[model samples]
Target chain A: MQTVIDAHNISKVYNPDTIPVHAVNSVHLHLNRGEFTALVGPSGSGKTTLLNIIGGLDAPTEGQVVINGINISELKPNQLINFRLHNIGFVFQAFNLIPVLTASENVEFIMLLQKRPKAERTRRVHELLASVGLSDKLNVRPSQLSGGQQQRVAVARALASRPQFILADEPTANLDSHSAATLLDIMEKMNREEAITFLFSTHDQRVIDRARRVITLVDGRIENDSAATQIRH
Target chain B: MLLKLAWRNIWRNRNRSLITMSAIASAVLLAVATVSLQQGVWEHLIKNLVSLYTGYAQVHAKGYWDEQTLENSFEIDKTVEQQVAGTPGVNAIAHRLESFALASSGDKTRGCLVVGINPAEEENLTRLSAKIQSGSMLESGQDGALVAEGLAEKLNLALGDTLVLLTQGYYGSTAAMKTPIRGLLHFGSPELNNQIAYIPIQLAQYWLDAPDRATSLVVGLEQAEDLPAVARSLKKSLPKTYEALTWKEMMPEINQHIEADSAGMYIMLGVLYMLISFGIFSTLLMMLAERQREFGMLNALGMQPWSIARVVLAETVFLTLCGSLAGLLLSYPLVWYLAENPIQLGGDMAEIYEKFGFEAIFPATVKAKIFVEQTLVVLSVGLVLAVYPVWRVLRLNAVEAMRN
Candidate 1:
């Protein structure tokens, strides 16, 4: 397994000079390729905050994040955006698919931004949407789809970029129990068969039970890691 | 793809987009109509002043404008007539001899300008026959006169009434004649109505005792815009002893009035544009606020700020185009109708305009450039208002926007 993400001494403080709140304080972690992991914590435990920093959506006040041996924290704003476009996939908590685009169009958007050829973009959009069991919803806009279907389209869009890893911030937060189980099954199958990496933040016990590895956070600090308890491959 | 997305996004909230588009269309319509009407009024003013007396241009003896005496008048020989008649844009030419005279009817007398004109040529240029309120138009070689309505009233004179005209003729000779008023002419111009009296060219020469002599040759063109080129051509073609003057040089007061009036109208139009810009800016601000979370999602999905800005700008461009084109199309029939049937001024407004020698009506122009220039102005206002959305997108904080 390859080491896909490495974080060292990450700290994020809000309003540091006056009545500061440490959102993610001095945390260090690593995620490997093909791993299905969950960052479990109560509310305000900084699980989402840490995930945001690792995904390059927010900057850490201290320390650095490395992805595929590159120091992502050192990149400039424009370069960081390009790097994220190529290397990081994000699944927001709200099923944030663009509402105006059809499922296939939403899935093809990132590839278009990458300037992929028309034939390749079409082929990849079909393949990704079909793999997510959304072949029938290809021409349906997000407004016309259910929450579970929209989330599936979002996952297809995330995979379109062929990023090194995916960071899902509570991907099942808006789904029912049945939908959540189906989504988790799809994600687990992708991890096992395609060897794609997924790191999610959730407080749901069902997600924790299905994860191959779990990291717990308390008060912006990593309390425990399953990797430390098991032998290295 | 981005543009297609933007196109769909605006239609997502159909009511909001339609309302904004209506506001833009209404603004464009009003602004265009206002500008067209103002320009039309100015053009009409110049046309009326020119055709009422001075035609498009005039060919005069070199020193006629400086000195009004009979010595400054010139002989209209065969060469001079042929030279002017062959000029390209010269639609018609009227020979005239103008001089100060005194008219009296039963002890009431007033000083007036006595103008001699070739009836057929003057009718072709100024449509003098149309201004005849009573009796018939003057004819060539007729010894009768056409007295203005106001001057007729001042002298207690009527059609067919004989009036005595007295003036000093060529070489200090006494010139006086009595002639019946063949027609009563009514003019919109106060100055002309109060003092002008027209008679046949032959009679004027016979009375002034200066035969075959005229002070100026008034040349009418096919269109008013051809005045400059035709004036230039005539100035070059005519003999050095004569000078050609366009309406602009002939009536500096009218030119000055048009310039001053247009400046004021432009200021009003500037204020109109500002109001329209603010209306568009308000709508754009609302659009930005409504799409905050969506913009944040896009940014979090690895989309650049400039890309988001481009999408927003594309949406604005689409809206402006739809609104502006519709407004322009709607304005066509309205402008055309108003141009053909001008709105009449009523009550004191008519009196005020008549007092200044202007017609009492508001007319619109159907010129192509008026529509084109107005569309560009409104589109520019839309573009200027787009800056708000672009700025908001460029500086958007993904986390904050998503949270909101």
Candidate 2:
């Protein structure tokens, strides 16, 4: 299987007066293409830190993270931004969409940044919004949307650019079980049907059960890597 | 889209936006009023002063005004009248004969300066003919004369009373003429206003035994704005024996008063700009600080630093444009109305202005430079202040911003 994300012995440290606090100590991670993976852990397990590092959002004290054969850590600051723009998408725990942009425009932001033709951006934005079942709410700002709807909009925005890999950090933590299950199903369908990789950092058992493969972490190290049972309809 | 977003964002916090906008509007209004009032008052003072003293601009016989004497008097034929009146910005030009003379009413004699003005064109230039308080102007080619109130009182001369005016004419000639004081004229100032008499140009010329001759041309301008330009142009085209001087050049004291007044106004305007700058800068800084998290969310959503900076600049530019334009629109009509009917100061205020030699009522006038300069200064201040907020946002770390 082609590797969508590969990190080797990644470590993150916070130094206070030259004394290091190891946030992620000697962490190694990998997510294959078309995989629906969960990084399950307790509080302070550094799962989110590892995900952030692999998503090209944060630099590690020591490591090499290659996403789709490109050495992300070796990229310059502006190149990393461009790399992230075309390759990796992130759905943060807070569903951080710009409050001023409409649900559709939020999804179209990356397209706008890429300077895509207006017609194509419009078409792709509408398609993504419809995929997330937000077609009727394109003009509504994020503040007016519900928590689940906002998260779905974030998912649509993450998938808007047709990125190969997507990372979700505690996406279902703030959602009700019904919305969480529906969101997991939507992500799973996109992952399997489109061969896109999905990575999540969470403690939600429902999210873990829905993910096809689970990577469990404890104390910044993977304790178990196993396949999840198929979700009962 | 960025502009639309910026516009929506500005109105998002209506109170803050309104506060900032109101501050800008009021500042602009105050600036307009200040400029118009100063310009209007100064122009009125100049015009009134010209009517009172030098008649806008004066044309003298070669060196007669530079060195006043009977010897310097030159012939005032139709040629001089045509030349003086043909000069650009010379709305009305007239000849005058100013000479030292003695006035006596039965042994009550006084030394006086007598000015002989052309009665035909003097009405437009000096308007002194209408100010004859006792009787009338020189009537219908009559050699009848007008005397200053103080000159009449000192000479004990009443209307229709006769007095002897004696002077040395051309070539050390002894000249004397007995003429009736047809009118008594009141003047504005205590200083030279009541020490002179006005007679018809021909009458004074004949009396001084220099027939068909006069001293200078008293010219009025069509527009004071063109005074300096007209003076320079006229100076270039002048006959070597003559000089063209605007009212400002003619009277050093009045020019000093205008410069001193403008200097004070400039200081006040500088202070006003500083005050407005502080108010606007603090408001923008506060808005920036309070919206750090909001901006962070925007950055996290992948808005480029340039995009963020652009949005802020657009908002500020829009705000200033709307505010300044509104201020200008409102001030135009206000100044127009004020110019038509000037404000009147009462009681002590009136007395103070009179003591200071300014009119009690202040007038307002529109000046084109006021609009252009006010815009440049205000926008420069705004553009300078915009740098702080943009730099602050650029220095922000996304993680720290989100954490905050």
Candidate 3:
């Protein structure tokens, strides 16, 4: 499989000069195309920090994160944002769909930022919403939708720009069991059918069970890798 | 897309947006109304003062204004008169041969200013006929004099009474006459009312033994704004021995008073603008605080910081534009009403204003320039205040902001 993300010795320290606290420490990881992976840890185990560094949302102080052969760690803030727009997708724990935009508009927004043609954006938005089973909720705003439905819209938005991978940080944390299961089913369907990579940081057992591979983190460092032939220090 | 986002974002907090817009609208209304009234009062004062006697512009011999003697007077030939009449903005020109004289009527003798005027031209230039309190207006080529009401009362002379004027003529000649008072002219200024004595130009020329000589040619303009250009053109077109001056140049005291009053008004306006700035800045701060997470999410989703700033700036522009439009809509009718039905002052205020030769009424002007100027100023203040949000967005950290 083609390696879509390659993170080497990544470390994120909150404050280096005074009262330094290591949020992520010398973490090395790799993710391949079409993989459904879960990064699992207890609270404050640096899972979200590592996910942020990998998703280009936060810069790692010690190492490089190369996504699709470009070292995003070395990119400027604007360039990093551009690279993320064209390459990475994100789903926050709160299902961060724009509150004002409707379901279809929320999904179409990413493609608009990518400067895609209207016809193409419309077609892709319809396809992605249908794939996530939200075809009837096109005009409904996030405030009018259920927690599970908003998350599905977020998923469609993530896939709207045709990025190399999607980064979801505890996406099911705010959902009920049935809604979480439904979301997992849709994500699994997309992962299998479209061959899209998904990397999620979660404390939820359902997500870990559904993920094909699991990586465990403890105290700002990776302690176990289910897919690695040998353990990483 | 950014514009749509900005438009939607502003309406998301409708009450906050409305409050902010209201503040801006109120500021614009107050500013426009205040400036309109100030300008209106000054315009009315100038119109009254100029129309009472002095025209908008004056032409004289180079040293005529400096020296009051008959030797400084100039002769106005037909060519010079035609040239002045043909000037673009010159509405009317009235010639005056002015001198100081002693008026004696039945043992009531007083020092007075003797002004010679062409009846038709003076009527057209200053509407002198409108100021008549008693008797009839002077006819062209008439030999009668128009005495000031106060001067008439001081000399104990009524209309149709004969008044004696005594003065030295040109080249040390004796100038004396006993002319019948044709009218009693009332003036707003006590000084002018107490000292003026008007006679026909031909009669004054004969009395002073200086034929065809005029001390000043008062020029009226079609509009007040044309004063400077008309004065300049007159100066350039006239002979080298003559100079043309605008009313402001001839009456520097009034000009200085207006300048000082304008400076005080500007300081007040500056304070008003500062308050307006704070109002706008507070709104911006609230908007940024409320949308911190959304901005972070947008940054994480691939929108550039400058793009986010542009959206915020667009929001401010829209709010300010809407507010300014509202202000203009509300102020226009109020100003128009005030202009049509001016506010009258009674009692001591009226007395003080009358003492200074100005009316005590307050009015507002409805000029398109005032609307455009106040709107632009409010818009500029809003845009300047928008810098705060833009700067904040530029330095935003997605991780921390999202956490907040």
Candidate 4:
């Protein structure tokens, strides 16, 4: 399998001078294409920080993150933002969809930023929204939609740019059990059918159970890795 | 898409948007009305002062204004008169041979300004016929004089009475005339009413023994704004020994007064602009604060910082333009009404204005230039304030902003 993300010796420290707090301490991880993986941890275990470093949203204090054969840590801020736009998709815990746009426009916004042709963007927007089972909710804004439906729209928006992988931080934390199961089913189906990679940081047991490979983090360190245990040693 | 986004964003908080727009509109309305009234009053003053005696522009020998002696007078011939009359924007020209002289009736002798005028041309240039208090306007080539009412009173003279005028003429020649008073003229200005006397140009020139010579040729203009261009053209077309002078140059105290008033007006306008700037800036600051997370999300979604700034700038442009247009629409009728029906001062205010030789009425002017100028000024203030949002967006830290 092609390696989509390769993060090596990544460390992020907050307030290093006055009171150094190691958010993510010397973590090394790799994500391959089409992989459905979850980074599971208790509270304060640095799952989100590690994900942010790998997604190039925040800079790592110590090491480098390579995505699609380019070292993102060495890129300038503007260049790093561009690189992430082309390679990574992010879903926040709060379902951060632009409230002013309808579901269709929210999904199409990424493609618009990519400067895709109009016909292709239109076709892909329809396909993505339909794939998320939101074909009827295309014209509905986020304020008018339920939390689960808004998250589904956010998922479609994440896939609109055709990114190499998607990083979801607590995607199911804000949903009820039934909504969470439905969202996980949709994500798993997309992973299986479309061969899209997804890396999620979650404390939910359902997400951990559904993920094909689970990496457990304890206090900013990777305590156990299911894929590493099975393949590497 | 940016424009669409900006348009939607403004309406998202409809009240906030309306408030900001109202502020801009109020600024424009106040500015336009204030400036229109100021310009109207100034124009009225200038018209009253210039039309009373000095025409919009005057032509004389090159060095005549500096030395007011009879030796500085120029000969008025058919060619000079035709050349001045043929200039564009030159409506009419009044030839005058002006000098200081002693006027006497019966035992009442007083020093006065003697002006020799072509009765017909002076009528067209200064509307001298309109100011006649009694008797009739002077006829062309009639050997008669028009005495100002105050001067006539002081000299105890009446219509059909002969007044003696004695002065040193051209080249120290004895200039003397005894002309019958055809009319008594009233003037708003006390100085002009007190000492001015007008006689026929032919009789004055013949009495002064300088035939066909005039001390000044006051040129009337079709439009007051054409003064500068007409003066420049007259100067260029006339001989090198002649100069054309606008009324502002002939009477600089009026210009000085206007400039001083404008300085005070500009200081007030500056304060108004500062208030406008703060009003816009505060609204923008609130907008930025409210949309911090959305801006961060957009940045994370791959929209460039400059693109977000463009959207904000576009929003500002729309708000300012709408507000300014609304202000213009609202102010037009008010200005037109005020111009048609001027506000009249009462009691002490009327007396004060009259003491300064001005009418005690305040009118507004409806000028396209005023509207455009005020709108551009408000728009510029708005656009300059918009730079703050662009700067904030460019320096935004997406991670921190998203936390907010």
The candidate maximizing TM-score is 3
The Cα local distance difference test for each model comes to 0.87, 0.79, 0.89, 0.87
10 residues in a row with least lDDT, candidate 2 chain B: B186-195
Ten residues in a row with the worst lDDT in model 3 chain B? Answer: B44-53
Please list the residue runs of candidate 2 whose C-alpha ends up more than 4 Å from where it truly belongs after superposition.
Answer: A1-3, A6-9, A42-56, A64-79, A216-233, B51-93, B99-114, B119-198, B208-215, B218-220, B237-240, B368-372
lDDT of 3 by residue, B1-404 (tens): 77888888889989988987888888888888888998888887777677556789888889877776889999877888889888999999999999999999998899999999999999989889988998988886788999999899999999999999999998797789999998999876666888899999999999999899999989988888887788889988899888788888888888888899889888888898899788888889998998899999999999889988999999999988888999899999989998999888999989898787667888888899999998999899989999889999999899889999
For residues B70-128, write the lDDT of model 4, one tens digit per residue: 89999886788899999999999999999999999889899999998998899888888
State the displacement of the C-alpha of residue B277, model 1, in Å, after optimal TM-score superposition: 2.8
Q: Place model 2 in a CAPRI quality band.
A: acceptable
lDDT of 4: 0.87
What range of 10 consecutive residues in model 4 chain A has the weakest lDDT sum? A224-233
Q: Report lDDT (Cα) of residue A129, candidate 1.
A: 87
A42-143 per-residue lDDT for model 1 (tens digits): 899999889989988899999899999999899988788888889988887789888889999999999998899999999999998888899899999998
| TM-scores for every predicted model | 0.87, 0.84, 0.93, 0.90
**Error in Å for residue A211 of model 1:** 2.0
Q: Native contacts retained per candidate?
A: 0.63, 0.12, 0.83, 0.44
Candidate 4 Cα RMSD after full superposition onto the native fold (Å): 3.4
